[model samples]
Target: MRRRSFLASSSVLTIAALALPIYPARANEPFTEGQTAVLLRLVKDIFPHDALSDEPYLAVVEQLASAAADPDFLQLLREGMSSLDGAGEGDWIDRIEADRIAALKEMETTPFFITVRVSALFGLYGNPAIWSTFGYEGASYEQGGYLFRGFDDLDWLPEPLS
Candidate 1:
């Protein structure tokens, strides 16, 4: 009995010790499929781009994913995902978006939401694919500025009233 108890306790401690480092892996590692999908959905909800496809949006995800590679960030994201809570895959995106935004609003002043929101704000818009979707050909610094590039010709928008 003593030998069995000793072995069991030792095994449990060894297993726990082995598992300790795995909790906080580096942020550079690719996220699991479910995590990536959840993250992509989160980004879309935060910054909806109707004209764009999944490709461009995924680019934004990749940027955020790098940030999420940090264990701290991964924990933050996991918490945020949980905040969005148990909506089904079939649940309406609008409903999910509303709920998640509300959850985030609750944590608006916290570092996690702030970091995520700011990162998404900057990362999502800067993709060239997103720019083209909005009819922005990007900076013409070498060729001159927006005057020559027709900066105002935004194709994604409806024509203004006369």
Candidate 2:
């Protein structure tokens, strides 16, 4: 093949590859579809923010899946899934909201539950996109602080004494 043709083709291929979404390559998937579904449900139930979409919860699960690459973490997750599934009637994923909440409450003290709770807290709330929904404008330090930026805009408060 001509050098020019080869270079052009290679460049095209490189650009195409770069344009594609790049997810971290995992040698073995951390969770099966069922497990992933359960994780999604579990994280959503943990937070129960009806205003937010599934994207943030999914991100949390993805983060957890990434952490599950470690053998120990994977084992913990698998065991946790089993315990959750066994705790109540049928699969935990199939349970109604009340049942699921009850099941989660039962396992609240477990390490697995704690890990997921902390992960959900940071994953769901830490996302900048979520901040707007909660009316959190984020840190004001970068914008010269909140002193001049509606610092006294609390309409719910009683008027201050002169």
Candidate 3:
């Protein structure tokens, strides 16, 4: 009985010791509730569902919002959002989306658009099942062709491009 109890206790302690490094406590990082809300709202707006399902979109938004709250991710978002605001005259997402489209047309450039576009792209691309819907084969050569491509052709492009 004593030997059994000793072995059980030692096993428990060993298991716990192994888990400690695998599950270290994350440091507390501050994030404003308002900012988080805005990010969620923006993600939902960018990827709304009609009658299919909301789970995938919601999950993507949650992941993105969590990243947005992180110090490093937040810095990148802030820079992109600030650039969007500076380039146009409205809310951050709207201005950035609009400005990005305009710049893409006028300059025939994609880097500016990519900064904002990639965020939404990532939200969708993160899910392998979602990528499969459009017949993506998951090769580097075929990756670009699988992305959302209708933004460039929106009616607003001509005016902004000119």
Tell me each candidate's RMSD, in Å, in order.
15.0, 14.0, 18.7
Which lDDT values do the candidates have, in the order given? Answer: 0.58, 0.75, 0.45
Range of the 10 consecutive residues with the lowest summed lDDT in candidate 2: 1-10
Off by over 4 Å in 3: 1-55, 92-100, 103-119, 128-162
The TM-score of predicted model 3 comes to 0.37
Error of 1 at 29 (Å): 4.3
* Residue-level error in angstroms, candidate 3, position 155: 37
Best by TM-score: 2
- What lDDT is obtained when candidate 3 is compared to the true structure? 0.45
Q: Please write out the lDDT profile of model 2 over residues 2-77, one tens digit for every residue.
A: 2223223434344344323323534337898899899999999999989989987888888778767667677878
TM-scores, in order shown?
A: 0.58, 0.76, 0.37
Q: Model 3 over residues 46-155: C-alpha lDDT tens digits?
A: 55435425555545545545444546555655554445445556654544554545533442232323322334445555556565556554655454653465436557
Compare the candidates by lDDT and give the number of the best one.
Answer: 2
Error of 2 at 63 (Å): 0.6
Displacement of the residue 124 alpha carbon in candidate 1, Å: 1.4
- 1 or 3, greater by TM-score: 1
Candidate 2 versus the native: TM-score?
A: 0.76
